[model samples]
Target: MNKEFDDNGAAEFEKLLQGVKPLAQDKLHFRPPVKSRKQIIENSHRQTAEVVFSDIYQPLLPSEGPMRWNREDVDPVEVKRLRRGDYVPEYLLDLHGMRQTEAKREISALIQACVRQNSPCCCIMHGHGTGILKQQLPIWLAQHPDVKAFHKANKEWGGDAALLVLVDVAEPTQKR
Candidate 1:
């Protein structure tokens, strides 16, 4: 069924849904909240001494909890690949000397080329400056519909100066 709503009708519908007449108000059953300050210390001198001791000499403790991060799961092959920059790239565009507008255009063109050429990955160097390029580039990159994922390069690569980008692989015939 086709449904269409006009401006006035939409407004009235919103008002009705919101119960703007105030006659349908429900009674809230929230209870009074409890408030109390904790009495942590009895004497100022004793408290100060305890605080100083705790700050200086935190004794070794037993490891009862498991680690939240996994180091062994890290792939050595992938790390080496990134370090050597061996990933087959579709295009490499340098933004080192280009202005902001020109850089954006170049990035867009490279992205289009990558998509058209069925490139799996690409690299972009934004440098570690005042974040003018770093900031603007990511915003545009994120907004790109063709971009699958993009991340900061590892230390072996350009590090934060470059990005590892994943692009949609186009059909074979579209390669340039």
Candidate 2:
């Protein structure tokens, strides 16, 4: 059978692609999805597959003391590594003048972004201006499940005014 140009088929193809556009490079995922489409939900307060941060119960944290926390399963050495400035922060968030509510949301977004980008380590500079955000940062971070560990930054990364956090993400599988 010899092929011939079918005008109707060509018109249908054009119609299908008339409004289609390429996905943004930044939005593209290079790795396979961790969860099925049904399990993933995207919203202002929800980004990660099944993680949410709550601000209701504030934990006991020293107002001016060095901030540090880690999940029970996480090793203490991880916090030591953060204090040593071993893992350079892949993302930095400066919450200078925002209120507690706004600061919380920004932190949530920061963690979500870090996980999506496969950046296990990041920094949050809450500043020592009013000491409001500074005091609240660790409380909020401790509530998130993805926050594996965090410690007060060393002098190089801002010292007493910032925190270095380690987010939980799957390690890249090596190809044999």
Candidate 3:
């Protein structure tokens, strides 16, 4: 064996690689860096505007008329069924004699509880008095994201004085 070659193998290897050029930078393509899962979730949450209730009350059309609201994707037939009181409410919140502020709080809490319990329907009796509650209830219900649909209760219930609210219950998230 050659003494020089055996002793300087690393030097000889470096000499062989001296003239070799690396691949062009433009030809070495790479995908853009992906966002972390937490970052994506935070971004999504940030993009959604917070729901605010202000100046929601206005003079409703008729004092005797039934009030109704439904999401655009909800079926009209289902709304008709709700109007007819086909589905019995699992819970009820009577806001009959309560003031506007108290009634609003009760309504919010009741709806949230019902949603958490996965209750499909609920009733809110605002009564047919001076029509203050009746006028404001629809606006408040419209603002609630979980309220899928709501209509004046049927005659068997409180009729125009009460509302049959259909709540959308989100499925419980499964853990990985």
Candidate 4:
């Protein structure tokens, strides 16, 4: 009777192990983390925050000359250098068919990029289209705190259709 019981148990165990296949290991695949994509989205959202180009204080810009401006603390020679094409732009943003809203967001992102990359200068190309962007771009650049100075581009840098902007990328020195 003991021999018969052992034989029955062994047969049952063998039946349970039928048709089990081993896992395949032929190819390697890489999947980037979903968190990486989420971070990218979050970063873009932060950069696209509403940058209010205030109308309460539009400085009377000359209609017939090269547009230029700078923060009160900035040196005038910075603007002169920009005019002479002494400072080459590290990045260039071209606004051709973009509407006002898109253009504004792009400008904001561009400034953020410049600040992040420690880029000292950038150029904005607002072509002579309907004159909408051309008129509004200087005001926007002037209002941005990061914009230390800007001037109409030199002939080699798109001339009257573009503006060279100086970004304040220097880390503030802490005092003891």
Candidate 5:
């Protein structure tokens, strides 16, 4: 009877094994925690295969430069007229030591606030970095949609290290 019982158990185990199917290759594959790993691997593999990078990847940057404006972009000699301290900045935000991302967001908020408050002009003291502001700030400023016009501040203001931005004032009727 014991032998017969063992034989039946072996038969049942064999049947269970027969019913199990292996997982699909796609399901069995593990994903790495790093997102860029896949891209990096593909890039490397293509390079080893003698495939040109252009075939697998597109350029990330545009060939064109930022918009350009001459003195004529604004009324002639109006900038000199602003020297009488007529351009009062209601809000002055100094991003002297903020991190790159923080500075960018703060600048955006400041521009919006200036507009909301109907402030005609504002001063941003980005300071003279060895070149940090020179590189990052300009990119942020150019990408900023709300910025009407900005230029290097006059020497009396802060010279090349700072910017004098003319903000669009909210219409009086719209200011609630």
Candidate 6:
């Protein structure tokens, strides 16, 4: 390789570059920084009312009766169908013997996997013992971005002891 460039070569390069101009900037163009997952979740929590299990649960409700919820965007007919157990769940998660923390983690994973797989419906069998899981399940489901709606399973499907969740195939943008 050549040890060095000739001085004339350097001067020629500089002269050729001097005529070139830098790219123009658009002063009005602006974009905010993308939020991290934790930040997005924290923001979502702040925007929605916190789910308190005690406030939401009704232990006295009969096991044979149906309990249901639907987002504003969900159709009324769809909720009716869910209440009737018309739609079969494609995924099932049984949190029978699991602790609260473990159940929570499992539910989150299950819902995410369902969404990724584009499965629209899932069932969770969380027995009606002290009604702890039954009570807390709604709160967790409500917080989940992918969950569009949820209803208590029908008599044949575990009744009050289980939940049939309707998951959105697409990523959820706004809070429910």
lDDT for 96 in candidate 3 is 78
Off by over 4 Å in 4: 1-49, 172-176
Ranking by TM-score: 4, 2, 3, 6, 5, 1
Model 2 Cα shift for residue 71 (angstroms): 0.5
Off-target runs (Cα >4 Å) in candidate 6 are 1-65, 171-176
The local distance difference test score of each candidate is 0.58, 0.80, 0.76, 0.82, 0.60, 0.75
- Residues 16-81, model 5: lDDT tens digits: 899688877665556666659877865554443332111223223223542121133456354444
Per-residue error (Å), model 4, residue 64:
4.8
The TM-score measured for candidate 2 stands at 0.67
How high a TM-score does candidate 3 get?
A: 0.62
User: What lDDT score is found at residue 33 in candidate 5?
Assistant: 62
Superposed model 1: Cα runs more than 4 Å off? 1-88, 171-176
How accurate locally is residue 7 in candidate 4, as Cα lDDT from 0 to 100? Answer: 98
lDDT of 1 by residue, 1-176 (tens): 12445777888888888844657788988987644333332243234333322222322322353101112333545434544566645566667866665675567667766866668678888787787776566555655556655556656546768776666666787645
| TM-scores of the candidates in the order shown | 0.47, 0.67, 0.62, 0.69, 0.51, 0.59
Better of 4 and 6 by lDDT: 4
Model 4 worst lDDT window (10 residues): 48-57
Where is the poorest 10-residue window by lDDT in model 1?
Answer: 62-71
What local lDDT score does residue 104 receive in model 3, on the 0 to 100 scale?
66
Per-residue lDDT over 1-176 for candidate 6, one digit per residue giving the tens place of the 0 to 100 score: 24356777888899999979989986875779889998886554444423321244433323454667777788867777888778899888999989876676677768767877778899999998888888778767766667788888887778879999998887456324
Q: Pick the winner on TM-score between candidates 4 and 6.
A: 4
The TM-score leader among the candidates is 4
Off by over 4 Å in 3: 1-52, 57-65, 172-176
* Clashes per candidate (backbone, < 3 Å): 0, 0, 0, 0, 0, 0
